[model samples]
Target: MATPRTRGAARAAAALAAGVLAVSLTACGGDDDGGDEDKSGGTGGTGTTVTLPRLDGESLEVAAVWTGTEQANFKKVLAEFEKRTGAKVTFVPAQDPIINFLGSKIAGGAPPDVAMLPQPGAIKQAVERNWAKPLGAGAQAELAKNYSPGWQDIGKVDGKQYGVYYKAANKSLIWYNTQVFENAGAAEPKTWDELLTTARTVYDSGVTPFSVGGADGWTLTDWFENVYLSQAGPEKYDQLAKHEIKWTDPSVKEALTTLAEIWGKKDYVAGGASGALQTEFPASVTQTFTGGDQPKAGMVYEGDFVQVNIGETKAKVGTDAKVFPFPAVGDAPPVVSGGDAAVILRDSEAAQALATFLASPDAARVQAKLGGYLSPNKSVPDSAYPNEVQREMAKALIDAGDDFRFDMSDQAPQAFGGTPGKGEWKALQDFLKNPEDVAGTQAKLEADAAAAYGN
Candidate 1:
């Protein structure tokens, strides 16, 4: 989601873009399975690698919401960039709420050479405000070589490319404790009905079937978006995000009602609705692993970034943790995804060089090797990741092709999509708390949508 600090703040952005939030790695443990050198780079449709000009005597500062292992991993990539070009690059951690900080920096005429924005809306906003610069030739060449058309489209505003998505997260995943599933004799659900049946089986096994992170409302939005995408399809999803359709539309009601089958089920969800309404994202993961006073939550739905939060728990990933793509509700399962879209805010040779470097398969390969970093660059290989789970998730994301949808709320305005206690987040919260009031929730949602989008 956008500008999420791991800041897990995708909820705070009102997150995400959840990539306005983070990725599909670490859901399984990092195995350091240093098998063979990845050969997926330098192929496919883009066919041209953008090579940046060597910077033997220059320095640049870049900003992103990364720290700890994530920061170190990116730094390793940057270090390689520095080594290859002799440019000294300084990595600055963006503030918890990055938009305001970035705006202030721009106003002061000191924006970083490049800023990694996780939210698609944020990138679009920057393009609209004329704060972003179009990609230079080197960057454009890399985009042509490495990224898919859909990803290329994500960074565009009015046909001008102003951003590059270096990192990605598959938001269409459900992470579960393996032991819980094995105990319930549950297999991964391929269809929504199957999912509900599995939930019942899991509940019958004396475990909470799902962990709803109602406290962090974005998680709830993810629940709604996935169902909406599969139920209503991508064209409608984009139309709604752009305010081409009202939230009160029947399709929305259908999606929300479908959600109620699970949300409304008592004990099917860990801690019940009230308890979930208070559990933030971190607690959602911890509780799934910990189970607190109840049997463990059999499954928790989140992007691959959930792996980091899972790391905070005692359970081992891959061995103890497992994941499945979010099940299909309609004719097709939805491939909803998001990532950190890096946009150049200041136009300079240094900025252009950094942007170009970031767009290349080489730069992506460096971080992909470290785990938790998924690249939209089509050429990057499955083996670039450290583990099989991540490798598979990466492949699924790529295979979804142009049919993929970025996180819905993340593609809308922050006031409508990313704020706290306002707009979609609050409306979805009300729905979670009172699933029987479907019509009432629809009205509230539309009213909020109108206010936020000024429709």
Candidate 2:
């Protein structure tokens, strides 16, 4: 299960370390130099020099959906921000489709100063609603020094900067149980057909081939996005992401049909369709690695962050558990990615200062050092990653530069892509329950997308 690393554009990687991208957050106008430059904020792990403005009595609130270990690790980063600027920042736990949560908070006039938007659509929504404030010049300078053009573009809407993507995830890997594969004599698959063959082999060896987290609709979106991107190519993927093409396109049907080749086989999934619908994301991952050779499932597909859950099991990565790129459906494997962007919801001197801090390598490095985190900032040194796997994964993302695709569903409007129990989430959940209805599924998708996109 040793996945071959795709060599990124060397020229692109070189350019990544050279450019300065734009960010928008107003500096709080605090100009008290705290001793030496290094003490206040010299290199601070970020290769570029960043001098943060002091905010002695400034207090700000930041909101995101991160919980558990993810929340704890992020808190450490906030602590560093506090130490450097003397700003008291509180972490607010918001629910998924954070726009909905923020809508109520904004209406209540108690919105956090900043929010981490999980999708481009949500960021766009924030801007459309006039809830998001553009970043200031100081924040833009740090972004230019630390981020590449592609990363910077993700946060820009209507030709204006609105967010800084601090955390990134590679969503095209499939982690599997080494013992199960070894026992089944199954080789890692490189193409879609080969994947089916491998699944059959594993099933004949008395174990399920896949562990699907159907309960969490976002997982289903990831499944379709990877398949659609690889099968239909990036052009159509982008068209669908922007809703420029209907979801009922022949291309969509083709991808769904191909997906059904696996979903149609109940024997291939850990708990069958019904059971999978009841399985949450965490359990789907734990099931693959918990029982050794006789685990409930042989493989689980997710982003690089899957390593965090693997840490909870008796299995060890690189040995008991290993990964491969999602099998190719077209000429090459799909390189789809997702991330969280820091957006200013209520502009303030403290709010803007924090945005600038996040854009700096100094902030990214703190989270990168902790296991299960990846940063898109090129200035983050390879040594920041805790292991070789993470370093390779992070390099792949930075190296890909502008050639890779962002998550498909994340690009669509929130009503069609991100909401829980409604829109695309529920539509796909229904599809997962009855994958046989490709036409019906496509129709539902098209209808929902039309409403969301106002087509």
Candidate 3:
């Protein structure tokens, strides 16, 4: 379906196009120097620019949950930082699970100089426990002025900034095959009822309407968060985030009921409940676009990162797949989930330099060039995006305004959070197995969350 681009997306596109034109002109003209002059190391009294100090003689280590494609992109940025500054970054890429590695390190009192925490709960915990240092007023002001409002708030703990944000992966998007929707004579649904009707119409046409994977447990949590915000609004969501509301609240129940109803539909989701339970997130995401059908599934509700996994297949972004905001249900504003903020441990000079560089628009442009994500920086143009899908996602993010919230699973405490082998993950798996027991499922979750929060 040809969903009309929202005003925010249109504005972002215009900004991006203008930025791209300027960049092209500058590139052609060989204007190599363009950055914050005050911040950029320029000529000094000694007729030599003061370079960022090397980490070779410095005692500092960095740890993070970055691996695979993300690691490569991170390394590329870090390498540039190291060269610009004389710092030797000893990056310990932990493929051996993030929490386990960091838990041990933090306990030993020898934590790394920087840690790229993908989970908001981990970032919050780190701040609460005094495991990291605040970025201070100066850094916070720079970030607020440079990045998106959503990103600026992500790093705030007790109204103080604790991290410097860089890349963001928007999750409140629904990706669909454009051709399939067009052929089905379907338009992107604007309201929850419209969405359901559209899904039913698409399903009645013999194609699966949605491809959701609940088997990973984390995926189910996504549904919960989406519905919660849609039903209760962002204010209530914020209350939930701050532990002011109970998980067993009526609003939470209503959201769970909506998920159960959606999941209960025959062929509403590909592979059924069993399929959703056993499949990994990426595999589940790929299921929506698999095979030679003109358009396999109508939509796949997932994060912006889904484009990265889909890129490995025969379908290319934009042509084969495009994204729209997960339509608002009732009076709720459109919301999207994603991760934000990159935290520096404050001990290493190199790490601080790296953080400063990343907070700049230059680093944001670099992230866009690498693909598979969007920068939280509003000033960075989307024209730097390599593909149309990335461009679309970036535009959606900028348009989301204050309605954008991080994934609930990531926002909760570690115990309630769906980390591997956690109770939250286990409960989701159990709930999916028996979709009839909605109350039982919620009770289990409420108990778990209360225990975790000491409520």
Candidate 4:
């Protein structure tokens, strides 16, 4: 769902903003030594290990939407698997809503051995469509050893596990151009009202306050999720995500009304709503950091992965660019996350072996060393991250523990959440274009959501 780049000034800034924060021994990172202590792929936290089956001359295909640095880094992980088990693993690039991609492949009877499913609803869909296989005992054990229960549960359908989430994103973050804040004499806002005040301050200083990546419907979903997760709280968030509650709920309206406070104001967003609707995710981030002392926008919101796009600019991460958690809209700030899970699409001994390796901290360690990545594996050491900022961000996510919620849009069916220009994505995009139509927006959202949810 994110584009990538080579690590440079923007990369450093993005790395900082991406929450390359620290993780402690008690958090996701444990006290294990950096080296592989055992060939068994042992779990540091569980003190148990599993011997992976040797795949000798076997070949496997692993698919995901990752490209650029992300794909490059994951190949490093796959390379390690090849070296360890003598199996050849090929990386297959898939499209967004990967379920559709896999569906075509499955229809052609040429499915990859394994696929990375980005949305929980997609994993469920794969299982329902019989395109995904339940993980073998070996892979399941690895997940139990390293992953949090919440992470583990996300890959399950009807109580049977299918995916091993190998990549995670902290979606509730706003990365800003620090020079903009300094010039405007603004501090990071701690509350929703304060955020608006800061925006006003920035605007008064002759700068647009925020960049909304409205071209990508998913970005709009992220904005709504953060507000709804904070304003309405988790229980209702879960209900809405599951379609147990309709989009027309008062909580939904309240969040929309609150979001309109900023989005409704043409001056607050870069290029205004019409312009924002034309800005893609990469441009939304680059515009904030590219203009030196004066940029088109002061801030852009997304996951820590925004750093990848940030790398496209000349800004130094901690210096020219920085991040603050999404400002609190209710009693507490929201921590909405997203991740990609490795699921077996064509089950076999080799595929199961690949799944097991992905669940191990061994695999997570490989990518963690590369910048702009986060892992939910509790056993990977803090030292695995290249720097302190990543460790700090990692620490924040791991620290959230039970308070954490996965991205709400990702929890819904792809037709509603993942699809571009449809369902919540399209409805929210329309809402962004016309923030004053709260009732109209709510009705449209309800209609799309009901159709998507089959309710």
Clashes of each: 21, 8, 8, 14
Q: Which portions of model 1 miss their true places by more than 4 Å? A: 1-29, 32-34, 39-51, 54-57, 67-69, 95-97, 290-295
lDDT of 1 by residue, 324-417 (tens): 6677787556667888877888788878888888888778877876667788878877777777666666765666555567888888877778
Model 1 — which ten-residue stretch has the worst lDDT? Answer: 12-21
Residue range 131-153, candidate 3, lDDT tens digits: 77777444555676777665777
Candidate 3 regions with alpha-carbon error over 4 angstroms: 1-61, 95-97, 108-110, 136-141, 148-150, 294-298, 399-403
User: Could you give the candidate ranking by TM-score, starting with the highest?
Assistant: 2, 4, 1, 3
Arrange candidates by lDDT, highest first: which order?
2, 4, 1, 3
- How much does candidate 4 score in TM-score? 0.88
Top model number, TM-score: 2
- The pairs that clash in candidate 3 are 54-86, 55-87, 55-88, 171-337, 172-336, 172-337, 215-276, 215-277
Ten-residue stretch with the least lDDT total in model 4: 22-31
Best by lDDT: 2
Instruction: Report the Cα lDDT for residue 27, model 4.
Output: 21
Q: Alpha-carbon error at 386 in model 1, in Å? A: 1.0
The local distance difference test score of model 3 is 0.64
The 10 consecutive residues of candidate 3 with the worst lDDT sum are 24-33
Displacement of the residue 293 alpha carbon in candidate 3, Å? 1.2
lDDT of 4 by residue, 16-70 (tens): 3334321211222122233434233343222223467778899999999888778
